[model samples]
Target chain A: MATLELRRLRKRYAGGAEVLHDIELNIDHGEMIVVVGPSGCGKSTLLRMVAGLETISSGEIVINGECVNAQEPAERDIAMVFQNYALYPHMSVFDNLAYSLKNRRTPKDEISRRVNETAQLLDIAALLDRKPRQLSGGQRQRVAMGRAVIRQPQVFLFDEPLSNLDASLRVQMRQDIRALQKRLDITSLYVTHDQTEAMTMADRLVVMNAGRIEQIGTPMTLFRKPATRFVAGFIGSPAMNFLSGNAGDLPGWLPRVPEETTEPLTGDISIGIRPEHIALTTPNAGQIDGHIELVEPLGSESLVHVRPTGHESRLVVRHVGTEQPDAGQRTGLNLQGPFHLFDHHGQRLATRPRLADTTCSMEP
Target chain B: MRYHRPGLDVAAHTLLIIGALAFMLPVILAVLASTQSPGTLFSGTLPLSFGTSGLDHYMTLLTEPVRGVGVPAWRLMLNSLLMALGIAVGKLTIAMLAAYALVFFRFPFRRCCFWLIFMTLMLPIEVRIVPTYGVVAELGLLDSYPGLVLPLLASATATFLFRQFFLTLPPELMEAARIDGAGPWRFFIDILLPLSRTNIAALFVIMFIYGWNQYLWPLVTITSADHATLVTSLKRLTIATDGTPPWHLATAMTVLALLPPVVVIILMQRWFIKGLVDTEK
Candidate 1:
């Protein structure tokens, strides 16, 4: 296992504009880092650069303290699981898992032993003779994983490997992958656009936007204290609601907004509040009043969409149980314990107390 | 409720039957002509008369002088096989390598090279025949297997078809193979080529038929009748007029010439359609 460091990595297609900018990330040994972003955000490009599928335009990718920028993917000693589960359609599952070993000229008996062991680990021993086309989506996914696992390379790279599976299968495979990674403790870099997958499965979540790193921290740290408005909005399901309210409108129960120095908040500043943090209360007890636009109930919880009076912004609140107010009914919103405050430039202000606050403190 | 369409179905089936009959007509005529004696073939008397019983035609083709040239039909058949197989193997190897490069590499001037190669498709061999002949003659490849095969080796049609095929293949397959420690050649042999069996089979059938039926190039290049392919030999045999055209033996020879390609098409019919259809998808 090796720590993979990408130092100011940049990628630009021939005669085309740059797709990725100066990306600097250090993946420590035995760490599982998930690069999460939206489509066309260059997450896949970054992963491909590390895998040697893409050429490094202007920077170095050092793996195990050696610069692999000039090396072929084969010489890099990495294994990758592709999103589409790129199993050889013509080969049986056994052959698919054994292909890499055979290519490396491994001994026949050892190849068989390793393949069989991986097949068993993936619970696909009975499917050894089946081709990829014959397998279901989930089975093909396991076969793709098995193909990578049998190699036991220095690093594992997954490019949205579970995105092809059904929801239940994706959840199951997510747990299986986490368990496998923890057990093997291989340095792995997983790329996905799914924020939940990144949040649940990563040792560190590298949130990206527009070919730039928005934030890199533990999942909870990112959720609680995102370093930018982009991270606050992108890292959660239903997304964090951004309110364009001034400091004068700050609720008395919540912490005071950070004072502006040198650069005053003359323009618009964004206040980020996650759905679950916002509470629905009686009109007199709440800070802001709005009419309920919609309520999406999920058995134990409900998402209440509220449009505050005289404001263009609609806020979503996650309330527990089926206790939901009727649509078009005037309701009040109570800002909860933690909220993210961002300047007009989208930089988070250092008002909250958290580990991610260190960087914010130095910014001012 | 949807209205039932009666006349449309009847018209569709009628048109389809007519199209099927039109396509089957040649094979039916060939089968019937092969069975008839030479004297009765073009007699145009009865449409379906069982002609004079004959292993004579088959035996005659085995022994008869083809045209005034005295080239045995069996030798011509063997020549056709050698030329076709040579062309098929050569075209497949070159096309696969070229296609693989175009699909998965980033060398300098790559797109420009691809466009230049692809541009050759617009200029058919007919357009370049005279110049091609001059080049072949200048290189002294005339009347040899290299003369017959080399000009056809760099097939833009096969390269184009294989490129389209390889482009549809998930890029991840190549990436996965590379990360598994397989170099470009290893990836091609172990991953890309194996997954491309249907495409290779389809291209093989198409190239074999093309080589088997090639007349213009071989006709101009091959000076020796012994080295001549079946199509050229057939042209000579049919146009000879030394004696009564041995129509029965000639038909049998034609049948022999058609057999290999026909068998290939039949055997690989599934993969041929699969390759074409999957590529469209």
Candidate 2:
């Protein structure tokens, strides 16, 4: 395993349009850094650039202190698991795992031994002689993983490797990949668009938007204190609710924060609070008054969509338990502490740091 | 399934049987004529009865040189086989390489090069036979296998077929191979060639028949009777400038000429259909 670093990495197409803007990251040995973003956010491009499959417009990718900007992908000694598995269609499972070893001129006997070892490790020993098409989607995914791990390269690159499977299979493979990476202790850089997968699998998550790294931190750090509104909105399930007014507009909103860091809330600002953080009280009992517009029950919790008075947007309040307000019933949205305040430019405001930490620690 | 109609089924069977007989009758007539003696063949109005000179006629044709054409039937068949195999293998090689370069690599004027190759589909050997023969003669490749096969090797049809096949392959396969430490040549040989086996077999069947049936190009280029192909020799045997044409030998040679292509088609029939229709990748 090796330390992988991306410093001021940028990518620009021949048409002079930039896709990745100064991406700077450092992945330590045995750390799995998952880059999560929407489509066209350049996360896959970033992974490809590190794999040497794409040209770096500028900056250097240093793996184990060696700059691999000029090296071929083979010379870089990195294995990548593509989203579609990308298994050799005509080659059997054993040959697919053994292809790189054979290309590297490994001895035939050693290749077979290593291939069998990998097959056994993946629990695909019976599938060694079967071609990729003969295998199911989950089987193919295992073969793809086996191909990467058998090489034991300096680093592993995964480009949304679990996105192709069904919902249950994706979750299973997500855990499988995480456990495999942990067991092998290989430094890995994985890219995906699924926020839940990122939250569950990444040692540290790099949340990206519009070709820029919005925030990079542990999954809990990103969930608790997203550095920007985009990260706030992108990192969570059911997403954080963004209100069009200042947090100061709600009565008793500022008093909840500690007095030391609570500045006079002024200027055009947006308030973001997690769906689970907002509490539903009687109409007019809370900070802002609203009528529940819709309620979607999801087993253990419910998503309550409430429209604040004289507002066009709906705030999705994640209410725990099966009890939910009726769609047309008046409900008061209490502005719980640990609120995210964003400036007009969607940048996170610098207030409420102390209250955020205290409330974050207090939550279950 | 569509509704089963007994009357339509009977009509369809009648039409198919007639079509099958229409196709098979000439071949049967040729086989029967090859077995007949010269006197019986000349006396005849469609001699359906089998004659006794079948072995003798075949032996004579196979062992001795024809009257006008100076090469034995086996030698002509051998030349035709060499030409067919050469053209089939050479066309596939050149076309595969051309398609590989076109599809996989990025170069300046790559599309232009592809279009230039595609334009050759408009000019077949028959259309460009004069200049082709000129080039062959100038290169002193006349009366050689290369002369017979070289002019037909730039197969735009084969190249297009391969390019289409290559395009259907996902681009991720190439990236995966590259990450696995396979260079361009290794990837081509180990991955691309094996994947293209069915396509190569299909094209071989087509190009072999095409090369075997080539008449005008070989006839124009080959002056030596020893280098004459079976098709061209058949023409020589029919248009005997000195006397009545050797119909018996011509029929026997025609029968022999049909065997190789038929065998190739039958052997590769499965792959030929799969290559055209199967979306295995």
Candidate 3:
């Protein structure tokens, strides 16, 4: 219901060590922004700062066009669903859902109506009287969601809320939360270390590393066009392959090398290619011939690990369908034109437009 | 998994019966002595049979004043009840508030304050009875209920137990409450106090019994018979210095004194176990 803006947001501990640095993000109204990062990357810290749980070292947090930097969490008109649910252990489900309403001094009958409505919405109408300990993990998650949603706050802040559930339950709750957020049309800020969850849940993902945002874009844009070497590695499962070599001494076997760039490709360059973008061909027929070292079959697709000639490291080629090249078979790797090129500084270099135009069916 | 050894079962039952009888012997003797007349009590080698004067003795103890002390048994029972209830309620309140402040707030020297409170465990009322009595007397609390209860009010053991229990609560609960628009006082009254119900129940049973059994402090401070507690008055009933002691009335008073604590333990025993087990973290 409200747009959340973090301008120059930074977090520093009393010991003078910075955990979050110059985080600038602007979330649109009714949009779900997932801040994805590795552990200790300060994604949760950034979310906590937005929630008013942590002090803002130097920044302005604006919600609904009002500056909330000095406001308390309650005064900021926000509700947070913690990673562990954080439901009051002694309270029943009904009471947990009705807590914020009662705190705001709502009428008795109105509070009961809203609580019943919320419980019905969550399909937990039968669990009104049971304490938190008696409920299963998924039921607890529903109650936690009910607790946050019943208030109808300006923004919902989720601090890795689905991380505690089992795998199957995590998937189900992830979809349920996405549907619920859409139905309510509430702006939400979710933090998680799981890239798959972020890729599916976020309208736009804020990929953070070492307290700074590496990129802020849609899932498809981030996956297809990573701006840095770190984003290229962090965004995809099975990760992208990186090969380093001198730029001026480009081997003849290298496929579709960037013909030109504003910055001179002089000292060294790295080639980044997605595992799915490399097709295995007959050895000595395609560019960069190598022998397949191993094949990891994962039902529909199998990842074939290849060792290129004169290279110590192995390159993984993600091949679609169950049929895969056998281990120890010699195969030539064909580069699908859209592979990335990074300079010596690990920054992505501008490539020709035709290379980015190859149709990608696997882009989620 | 089911062990159905008849011989071992019989042997185990026999041992359990012996242990139970050994523990209940003193209480059984007290009940028996209370039932008998003084002459019947002194006549035999600890008579196992009940005397016919049981009803008469109990009625006299309940309705009439004791011969030398001139105070009804009910009055001493009421005094002990007040002292026990007072100490239990007072200790729980102080301990809970102290523990709440220690665990939830980040004030200056909070740990130092906790350690100072913890240090009092070494200086129990028995260890510092003289100085405690001096303070109570100087404050004009002698021969008053306050004198008996106030000196035993500061319980370091209960405070420590509460602090440990409070520390087991997740910090996220407090943050959630804050985001839910609950201030500190609301959080304490609504969330914390309700969550601490089992802990308070367990501590109440303990502190009540501890205060009821207090002998040395009441004996030192309470000079007037009007303010005598059950345990202190029982001492006066036996050590007469002039004539044969009224063993029947003293035994009757002892039986009365044992009822409240037993009833309390039986009532709160379930919650006491649950509290200890639930807050183990």
- Which numbered prediction scores highest in DockQ against the true structure? 2
Model 2 / residue B171 / CA error / Å: 1.0
Which stretches of model 1 miss by more than 4 angstroms? A245-268, A352-364, B1-47, B238-249, B270-281
- Per model, kept true contacts as a fraction are 0.76, 0.78, 0.72
The per-residue C-alpha lDDT of model 3 at residue B278 equals 61
- Candidate 2 chain B has its poorest 10 consecutive residues by lDDT at B272-281
Better of 1 and 3 by DockQ: 3
- B40-143 in candidate 3: lDDT tens per residue? 87776678877667667778877887665668878888889999999999999999999999999989999899999999999988899888988998999999
TM-score of each: 0.88, 0.95, 0.94
What TM-score does model 1 achieve against the real structure?
Answer: 0.88
| Predicted structure 3, TM vs. truth | 0.94
Q: Which lDDT tens digits does candidate 1 get at residues A1-364?
A: 7899999989998898788999999999899999999999999999989988888899999999999999988888888899888887778899999988998899999999999999999999999998887889989989999998898888999999999888999999999999999888899999999988999999999998888999999999998888999999998888998877565554343334444222445456787878987889877456667889998988888889998776777889998886667898998777663667788779987762443332211111
Where does candidate 2 chain A have its weakest 10-residue lDDT segment?
A: A355-364
Each candidate: RMSD: 4.9, 3.1, 3.4
Q: Is candidate 1 or candidate 3 better by lDDT?
A: 3
TM-score of chain B of each: 0.88, 0.93, 0.91
Which residue pairs collide, candidate 2? A275-A318
| Model 3 residue B279 lDDT score | 49
Indicate the fraction of true inter-chain contacts that candidate 1 also forms: 0.76
